[model samples]
Every structure is written in C-alpha cells, then in structure tokens.
Target: MGYVLGLGGPYHHDAAACLVGDGRVLAFAEEERFSRIKHHRDSRSAAQSAAWCLRQSGIGWADIDDVAVAWNPYWPNYCDRIGDAELIAELLGPDARAAGAPRRLTVIGHHLAHAASAFYPAGVTEAAVLVVDGSGDGVSTSIHHGSPVGLRTVRELPYTQSLGWMYQNATTHVGLGDWTNAGKLMGLAAYGQPRIELPFLHLTDDGYHLDLTRYGLPPFLGADATSRYTDFSYYRDLKLAYAKAFTDAGVPAQPPGGHHPDRMAVDLATSVQAALQQAMLALATNALTLTGTATLCVAGGVALNCTSNGILARTPAIADLFVQPAASDAGCALGAALECARRRGDFTVPGPRQAHTLLGPEYSHAAIETALAAAGARYSTPDDIAAAAAHRIAAGQVVGWFQGRAEAGPRALGARSILADPRSTTLRDHVNRDVKRREMWRPLAPSMLDLTSWTTTPHGPAEAMIVAHHATDTAHEQIPGVVHVDGTLRPQRVDPQIQPTYARLLREIQAETGHAVVLNTSFNGPGEPIVATPADALASGARLGLDALAIGDYLVDLTASNTTR
Candidate 1:
C-alpha cells in the first residue's frame, strides 16, 4: 500500500488532512470539527485531523510512505510557516518521522492542490480549472486544465489584486468580521441593488488588477508582510478600505445593522458580489479559451462564492462545471493528496470520482445512547426514527438531526443538521433570533430530495452546497423559510443512492406535509463549529433551542419533561 498522507493548515486557518492509499482516499477531516472552534487557526488543529485520518486507515505514521503538504514555501516567495519536511517532522513528532526513514516528502502549489481537489474527485477527464482564494503561495487566483493524463497551468495571478480580500474588507465594513462572516456578506447582497463600482479595479490580460490607494491602502503590503497573507488582524482603517471604495462611488455607507431601507451596506454588498461574479466569469471563460476545455472545475475560497458558481455553470463556454464542496482552504489537503498520488502513478487517468463526501467520523448507536444517558435527557428508541423526525418538522418543531457520518465542508447536508419546517416565512427569523442568536439578516439553507423537485436550474445533481440555485415559484410558496430575499437559495441535493437516510427523512417529511424540503443548518448554534461526536450533538441539541434530536435509532425530545418517551 502506497500510503500518502496529505496535510493542510496549521500555518493559517481551515486546517485539514486526507490519507490516501491504493489510489483512493481513506479518510479526510478538518481540525475545526474535532477542536470545536470555528476555523481553528493552528497547525496543531490540522495535525490532529491528520492523526485522525491515519487512525481511520488503521495505520500509524511510521507505516506511511509519503507526506504531501498542500503549501509550498518557495512559490513566488518564502515563509517560515510553510510546511516542508522539517515541518512535517515537527507535526508527526520526531519519533514517528524517525521510524518512517527517508519517507518521501512533497510540496504542492496551493492553487494546483485546489485544482486537483476539484478535478480529480469530480472524475472529469479534461476541464478548465480556476482556483481563487485570499492569497495562497503568493497568488490569489490561478487557471489550469486538468485531465486524467495530468494537470497543467494556464495562468496564475498575483496576490496584489485579490477579490477575496476586497470582499473581506467589505464584510468588516458591514459589521461582520472578515473570513468567517464573508458568507453573511454574500447573503446580505441579495437585499439591495449594486449601485457602486471600484475605480481602481479592472480586468487585465491575465486576470484583474487593483490599486490599494483607492481605499487608502499602499500599493503593496508592508515589506515584512508575507505575500501569501496581508495583515488581516491589525490593519489600520480596515473597514474603510472597502467602505471608501463604495462611498467614493457616490453611494452612502451602510448603518450598523445593515437594515435601513435606503442604506448603502446592502448596495455595497450587491456591487461587491456583482464585481466578483463578473471577474470570476471572465476567469472561467478565459480558462476555456486558453485550454480549449469544455468542462470546468473551480476551487479556493472565492470558489465558495456560490452565486458566482451558479452564474459560471450557466455560461455557454462551459459544457460542464464541478466545484469542490470544500472549496475553501480545508480542501487543499485533499488536493495535495491527489497531486502526490498522480506523481506516484497511482492517480490514473480518469481518476476515482467521489460518490459522496461522507469523509468525516461517524458514531455508533452505543455512543449515542451513552451520550443521551449522560446528558440526563428524555430519549427513545424510535422504531421509525425518520418518521418521528419528519413529524417534528411537520409540526413546526425544530429538530437537531444527527445521523450517519459528519459532513466535511461548512454545510450541514443532512448529517449533523438542525432541521426545521421550510414552509413558514417566519421560521428564518425564529432560527436566527431564538435558536442561533445570530444576525437577523442570516438566511437558512435547505436540503431537497431532488434538485429538480424545487429548483429550476440547468446545472446539477449536486450534493455539495458549493453552488447557488434560483427557486421556482412553486418552491417560493412551499419552502419560504429556506429561500433568501432575492428569491435564490443555497440548496443541497441529497442523493438517494449515497445519502439514503437523509433522502428517506425528506420523503417522510413529504408524506406528512406534501413538501419534501427542510430548513437545514449546522447542528451547533452561532459561533460554534458543526458538532462531530454524539456528545457534542447531545450538548448542542440541549441548548440550541431544538425541540428534538434524531440520532441513530433514538429520538431525544428536549422539550419533554420525561426521560424516555
């Protein structure tokens, strides 16, 4: 067995790991899931995920043949945090590395890894690749072409002009913090019009260029600043960076809560989203022009821009599009592993395609029972767990649904999710205010038994929540709780073949309410990472304002006063 362990993060956020053997991924996990920290910003967190991956493979570090790191310190420039042989040694510990003598070590370019994660797992023969994020390996965006034969670069852009950072600064200006709240900004964009423009940004032959002076920033970051990261924590007038970019465009700045009718925050979000989508569209089109590939794959933080992804999927230049579900930095490890496997001639042409992303850990019924028993809560061994969960949702009672394996990405695709009735318009606010205690503007996502059942899109049978979809009028009426203000929704298409449990639950809901949709959010409340273990699930279900938790064959009703009903 050619055991290849791929690692990401520990240097920054979204740390993750994937272990590959015999040309297939054995396991993959993100640090934040185990650590219970949202985007756990440490290498140790990712190292923990690596250890978990190794354990799932039933092997130790000493048995591994190679270590493939997702970041290269030498690309465009050098940084001390980049993971190399010594860094890997440090992570695995001296003892483990010592036993795995002369273990092959490999470095993958950040964007290349992103491309690999998208193209390889997607099972695409040849596709134009687009990788975008907040600066990795000194580049914010790169274009490539991927085939089972190999992956080839078309062009790479410098980090000086980053769409991701502009979006981040915009996020901060609107009261949401950067990195984590960027998606909130995406949701906010739907409420207003795009009445502004950035004067310093324009498309170039390669990609786009920006002048920081437009936002009162220098042409470049500080000399000591690493090209891969430009001071997100302590920048002077950080919000003003993107705020002025809009205020200078003759639009007013938004109020604190971003709610007022004539306010500019929503408009700024709208314009930022528009500019980003247009730029990404250009990049994807150009990738096709340069590579002459009809199929396309996108990854990286910007690839997480679901609106842009939806637009890109509809572009005539692209015959097929596949965006990795974990398009963010957490997916880089999977890409690195795929890249190493290619080098070893194990990732053959037309490589293995992912049937699903249930790559994280799963808990047994014994563990679930133990957790519920320890919590001193009311629970039951329901003969029909799915039917009971469906009844709760249909009765307008919120539920914490924990079943099978935990999902890998930020989405709660059935497995570790809070389920609610999607037919009520007030449900969104209830979940936001009473349950999640999050910003009121935050919208809820949904899982449909079939994409065609609700959404009207030419694009997919997608299981990952990486792309966006527009709702049909029928959907608007039936699933009002899940639809956003702009009539668009981020939906996960639960496959019956791979996700039988989740699909059956949806069917049960349909049997009760005539609608096969449920508002699905992560199992945890605001500011908490998605719950991983049954103990975590039990703890979150008790305090998250959920009425019941449907885990394994057991149904735990928190609202009831009894121990087992």
Candidate 2:
C-alpha cells in the first residue's frame, strides 16, 4: 500500500492536509485550527497540517509515496494565470528536492478532485456527483457520474454563474467575511420569508447566473486585485449594490451590539438563500436526469448548506444522498489524492471510509492537565468527565467540552464542542450573542445521544452534522434551542458506539433534564476555526463567555467573575 499525502487551501478557506494510504485516509486536519487564523492563506498553508497528519499517523516524509494537491495550473475551463503550480512548488521541502530519486507531485483538476472526494470514500459504487463552489479552476459548478471505475463530467457551469458568490454577498452584508460567512446567511434565512428578488441574481434553464451589471463588480472571479498587496477584494462594488438596495428598501444596517439582521436584511438573506436552493435543486435534478443514478454525492463549498442539503435529501428524484463532511475546499485535497490514486489504474476498491472525519490530533489526559497547569487554572480531575459536563449543562451553565481527536471537517461533533442546555430557547441567544458573538437568528444544533427515540427524519448519517431535518413536535417542545425558526434542525446524532463520551454525557444529561439532547456548537469563538488543542480550548473558554470547561478529566470553572477554579 502506497502512502499519499493530500494538501489543500493555498488559495482559499479551510487550508487542510490528509494522508491517504491504500485508498484509506490515515490522518487529516485543517491549517486554520492549528494556525488560529481563520481560512488562513499562506505559503505554508498545508505544511503545518501535513506535519500534524504525519505526527498523528506515526509516519515521516520518507514514508510518503506521493503528494497530491487539488489545483491544476492549466485547466481549460478557467482563464486564470498558472500560479497554482508555483504555489505547490514553493511548499515542497528542500530535503525532498535534494534527493535524486523521482517523486510524484501530481496536480489534479479542481472539480475532479471535488468529485473524487465524495465518490471514493462514499462506499457507493455508483452515484450522480455534483461539485459547487465559489470557483473551481474557473468554474462555479460541475456535474458528473461517479462509479468505482471513474467519474465522467456531464455538464459544467462557469464562475460567472455562481450560487456561491451570491451567498457570500448576502453573508458579507451581514458582517460575516465574504469567504467564510455563507453558513451565517443560511442560519439567518430560516427567520425570514423571501418576498422579493434583486436584479443581480437570476436562475436560468442551465443554472444560476449573476449579472455583473447588477452585481456592480467586474465579471472576473477575482478582479478586485489592485496596485499593492494583490490581495483580492470580495465583491466591493457588489456589496455596495446590496447596501444601496437595502437602503432603498428601507433596511437599516445592523445596529451596534451584535443583533439579528434587521427586518429587511433578513428578507434579502431569505431571497438569496431561496434562489440558491432553487437553482441547486434544478441542477441536481438535471444531474439525476443526465446520469440516471439513484444516489447523489455533493461536494465543494456550496454543498455545506445543510438547508439545501435537507431539501435535496427529501427530493423524490434521488433515492439516496451523501454530502462529503469536509465538503469545502479542504476536502478537495483528499479528493485530489483519491483521484491521483485511481489514475494509477492498479488498485481495487476498499471498504467505505467516507464517514470517518475524526482524523485530526487527539489529546491525552496528561496533555490536558499540562495545558491547565500552564494557564494556572484551578480544577478537579473528575472520575467521570462526561457526567461532570452533563451536570454543568443541566444546571444551565454552558460547558466547553473538549475530548479526543478533533474532527477534520467544519462541524464540531462531540470531540471539540461547546455544550449547553437545549431545553432553554433563550440559551440560543446567550450563546449566539455572548459566546459566538453572532446574530441571534443563527440557531444552535442538537447533538442527540440516541437516534431511536428522537422525533426527526434523518436523511443521512447526521453524525457529522451535515443534513438539516424537520423537527417533530417532541423535538420542538423538549429541545427548542435546537429547532430553527422554520421548525427545522440540522442535528448531530451519533451512535453510542462511535462517540461513547458524548453519548454518556447525553445520557447523564437525560437523567438530569429528561431529554437526550444538548445544544452543541464548534468549540471556538466567532470567526475562529474549531479549537484544535487543549490550550486553544482553555484560552477560548474565558473569552467566548463559557461558564466552565470539561477538558478530558479536568473540570475548570471559567466564570471570570470568580477565580479560574
């Protein structure tokens, strides 16, 4: 079995790395979690992430058989300059280059890698694959039929026609960074109903197309680059167009002290989200029509929309659905490695590996103690960490729960998460405003311990918190904090065997509160990547307004009003 290292995100958000050996993922992690810079863009974007993967996997650079990066310098689809090659070349180590031996440094197509990321590990032999993002080698979306043998592209939509850009525009208007705020808009959209549309966004028979004249930006994807740092601006004039439209519509900018998108902002967010959903559905239906595949696999940045994913999951056209947990650009590295492996044309298909996303570094009990000691934190090593955490949440105290290996994807899952009482809807406001420092319109998610008793129609393995589901009245009454304004929820429901710590905590909380749910979110402050280390968790707890922290065996009281007991 040959070992291949996969790297991604030199260009955009969620810079990440993965080690795939024999077509199975050994280790993976995002650079942002390690660097503490959200969506970090740097020459060493994949270097730290790659080193972490090697450390966790107990392997060295000498053992690597190949390196696959998900950027093709010369894809005919996009007219951008061929700098992706230079970027990859700059990241290679000198020792590797000094060797006279031949090495594989393969450049894989952007969208093909996106397709492979979903197809190879999906545990399915055949499926209709869709890749949608802000831009992929110059295109916004691609549809393909994926099988064990290979993937064949059926249709393509250029970057000018981008649902992703539209989402980013709305997200930026609400103060979330353009590249990193689509989720905020998706969360906000639930609070509103679309009563209008702007001329900038439109859906056609082919797909969604953004009219530059209406968007008020140049037609090119990154045309905002000016004379100095060459850093591209995200929809500068396009944002002005939104601001003008909102002003004309009588929608005021969000007031001081973070709050929900004022009434009219919510309306526009709703419109953008609805339009994107409709356009995506149209494309997915066409994918089904073209490929005649019962299963659909979604990849790329836009696929992270759990609301659209929920709607797609319930579609009558597709019988099965799978959203690559690391559906963003980060997973493209994994996809690139998988595609490179298949290009060798010599390996047999392996068992399903799609659902295993806990590929990052895990901390031992000793390490957590070290971090506590370093911070001069006062704490007690509880025999039952999960119970202690459950008790705190049950008592209406928000608990920062950090355990085991960090999840490779965006969702926190149970490993590195913030836990709270789901019974109180008002807690959503507390966490949203004080902890996350985001608008209250964003709903918290329920991480259910047991799925059997829950009142939800989970369309897929929601353990990774990807698909949105309509909540039953039982969910609404018992765990209102998790239920969104639209009576829907995107839950992280895990198997007891898979996450015993979280499951035990839920059971303990259930014993206390009579419900098997907790309001769970990524263990980080707003605009930050999920916490990666014990120190990261410790520092963020006090700043993010958490009451306490359950780090491994230690229970740290983080109520700053009191001592750090």
Candidate 3:
C-alpha cells in the first residue's frame, strides 16, 4: 500500500526513475524521452521527469512513503574530492518535500543499488553480486554476497582503477563519442589486434592499480589529476604508446578510419573483449571465494556487456546469473525505490518480472486513433494492422513499428522498433544505409517469439534486447541478417503475457515467414531519440527510407511517401 520512489545518475547517461508499489515495479522510464535530450542531465530536467512518474501513477508527491537516492553522500572520502555538504543537499532537494521529510532518508551506495537491482529481482536468495560501470557514486565496481539477511559488500574497486573507464577512454581514442558509442567500439574491436602497449589492469589483495606510466601517460597521477581534466590528451598519449607497443608485440595498430585486415580487427576485438571478461570473472571468483555463493546477479552499465555476462554464467564458480534489463544508471531508480521499501519493512518480493522494459507508458486504442486522425493518416483495427505489418515484413519490406509505451533503456524492444525480414542478408545493409545511417559494420538485433524453438543458447532473462549471447548455428543460418559477425544475437524474447500485441505480431510473422524472429533495430535515425509519438513515427518513417509505419492499430502508407520522396 506504500509507494517508494527511486532516482539515479541524474544529469548523466541514462538518467531515470522507478516507482514501486508494495515491492512491485509500477512504472520505470528514462528521462531522455521527456527532455528530448540524449541523456537528461539538468537537475531540473530530472525533477520534471520524476514529477511525471508521480503523475502517471496518479499519486501526489506527498504520497511517496520513502525516497531512496541511488548514491550515498557519505561514502568515505567522497566529500573530499567533490565536497560533501553541497552535493548531498542538491540531490536531496527533490525528495525533501515529502511529508515532514522523514528523519534520516535512506541513501544507498551506488554499487549497492546496482547490486540490489540485479540480485533482488533475480529470485536468487544466494548469489555473488558483481557491479561494474564507468563509475558509480564513489566506486567503479563492487562485489557483494546476497542472502536472507541482505546484500553485504565484500570487495570494491575504486574509480581510479576502472575497467569501464579504460574501455571508454579507448572508445573515445577510436573516434566514437563517449557514452553513446562504446558499443560501437566493442563491435569495431572485433576488427583490430590488441597491441598491448601497456599491460591491461589487474586486481590484487590490497587494492586495484593500473600502470598508466607504462602506457606512455605521465606516472599514475592519481585521481585528482585525471578528474580535473576533461580533455583526452592523456588518452591520446596512451594510444600512441599502444601503437609503439603493438609494433613491438608484432601486432599492427590500425590507424583511425584506415583500412585494416578484418582478421586483425577481429583478433584485437577478441583480445580486449576477453580481457574484460577475464577481469570480471576474477572479480566474481573473488566474491565467491569470500561468500561461498554459487549464483550471481550483475548490474551496472557494464553488465549490459552480454558477452562478459555469458562468460560468467558458464564459469564453474557461478551457477546462475541475472542481469537487470535497465542495468545502467537508469536502473538506479528501481534500486532506490526497493531500498526505501526494505527500510520501512514494506518491501515484499513481487516475484520475478517476466517483462522489464515494459514498465513504461502505454497508449490506449482511442488515444492512438486520435493521433492518427489528427495526423491525417489512414488506419485499421489491431488485428488487420498486425497482419498487414507482418505481411510487409514477410515480403522483405522494412516497417517502422511504434506501439504502446516506449521502452525505458537504450533498446527499442518491440515498442519502438524498425523491423525487417531476418532471412534477407541485404536487410542489415539496408537498415544501416537507409534507416539507421550509422556504421555499416554495426549489426542489427533480433526479436524472437519462440526463442526456445531456435537452437540459440538458452535466452537469458531479457524482455528487452540488453544482453548479447551467442546465437545457435541454426539461428545464425536462419536469421543471418540479425546475427553479428561473431555469430551472436542480442535477442528480445517476447512473451504473450508481457506484450500481447507484440506476441500476436510475432505469431503472424511466423505464420508468414516460417521464422519467428524479426530483424529489429531502434526506431530512429542517427542522433535522434527513439520516436515517442505517432507523429514521430510518421516523421521518422518519411525521413528514413521505411516501407511502412505501424502505430498501434494503424498502418500509414509509407510506400506512397517513399515514392514521392
């Protein structure tokens, strides 16, 4: 009967909120949609979105029983670097208005919130909880043991020694934008060789350390010097050092944007990807050694690294792994909400969520009809629209599918998606050139209705295509367009109960194409946010070379617009 609100990573990448009622997630959403900014950063903007969540739930600000912010203002020396009182006061301003402002608000540590989001929802009573990301409130990564008593932090890797930052620096060095393009660097890494200019980071019993000096950067200047500067000159220096090291190691470094052998890129990508996986495993192993836990729950920006997650799942030290769909900063909202509920003794495990990203705003049939009629577009009933969209997709025509409730995370899921026939190899190239207009090497993802039927690895608990896993040979052959060069597919296995319309569409597509999966990608062009409204769908469809627009029960004539364009 109580409502708890959680907030996390404000003014940063994936700023979001999660509202929980009696321990069940009621609504969760990212700020980017309302703010129209890639990642809502302005404190005011975050507050506005939080207000929206309250309104959407038909609750008042005073109704929030407890407010848990994902970051702790009192972590050891956190105030030393960023000063204590000011940042804490600023963050607490939003929640301070709640009914006499309850004495002693719950402030969960960044990594702990991440751990809770991962482990609690996993339905695992005992598991090793591993947290990794660019940086948390104070630490970059942490390992914890989850049990009936609650989660206990066992080991921590401070921000000074972060694997996520290393990858981010490398991502920037490779010419992609930070935050947004790290995944692109990962995909591109599959194309290069790790020159090993400096040794990759390693963890020890005392603490974590990196030999940045060996990488041609000035001696480990510690956190102060690195934190003060925003420019990436130091990273550039590291890249140069890497180039020399590659030459010495008998591996050539590919110049930025220059042509290099595909095998070379693949080898380099594999090496770094392996390094990340091994480092994560070492951390998990350490957690298991200390806690004697066989299951693992992982969350954080890095947990989105499905390859690394899959590796942990197969390790002898770990038996099961659960990664929250909104694992990044955005998910901190859910953790914060859960922390509040637990402290008030109101939290009850609401059972496992069959669908994660579906916790957002959904449009009603009347609402969608109003939009379509206002836009002067033709429409149909849900069944006819689904059938027609399925037919176009089966005919190898690209369709822009924008249905109820935009997904909360970076993934489009079935809500905001551009779908095509997975059987067409040309579909991948077509999406990149005409619609996505991004890197050619970047592969598309898949949405499978009957994920179990495909020989692909047992689909992880993903309602949104968040974690990447190896595709079975049959999957690779059947959906070549969605399969990456590495033979993996980031599939969103749709369940009928979670999204009945999406499930129905999948069934129709299966009946038409003999395959249950559709080539799915985010429903937006490069540098644009995922379409949020029916008008957005039409605008994006016209802007991008889409074959059709499916907005709820309506199917706009994209073919007519395509000819006119």
Compute each candidate's TM-score over C-alphas.
0.92, 0.90, 0.87
Q: Mark the regions of model 1 whose C-alpha exceeds 4 Å error after superposition.
A: 42-45, 74-86, 93-95, 98-104, 204-207, 214-244, 250-262, 458-461, 562-565
Ranking by lDDT: 1, 2, 3
Which wins on lDDT, candidate 1 or candidate 3?
1
Q: Which tens-of-lDDT digit does each residue in 158-259 have in candidate 1?
A: 676778888887776766665777888888888788877667678765557777675776555555345324444324443456677666776665454544
Off by over 4 Å in 3: 41-44, 73-105, 192-198, 203-209, 216-268, 349-354, 459-462, 562-565
Task: Give lDDT for model 1.
Answer: 0.78
Model 2: lDDT equals: 0.77
Candidate 3 lDDT tens digits, 1-565: 7988787775345667788888777888777776667666545225545666787899876777776777654444443122333443454444644423334445777888888887777776677788888776547788888776667888886655667877665554445555566677667664555544336456554334555555465543566445433344544565566454444444454445422334544455556666787678777787777788787778888887866766775676677667787788888888777766766666644346335576777677787767666666654454577788999899889999987777877788899999999887887888887778887887788888766655345745545676667778787777789877777777888878867778888889989988878888988887777777676787788789788888877777766733321
Report the alpha-carbon TM-score of model 1 versus the true structure. Answer: 0.92
Better of 2 and 3 by lDDT: 2
Model with the higher TM-score, candidate 1 or 2 = 1
Better of 1 and 2 by lDDT: 1
* Model 3 lDDT-worst window of ten: 79-88
What is the C-alpha local distance difference test score of each model? 0.78, 0.77, 0.70
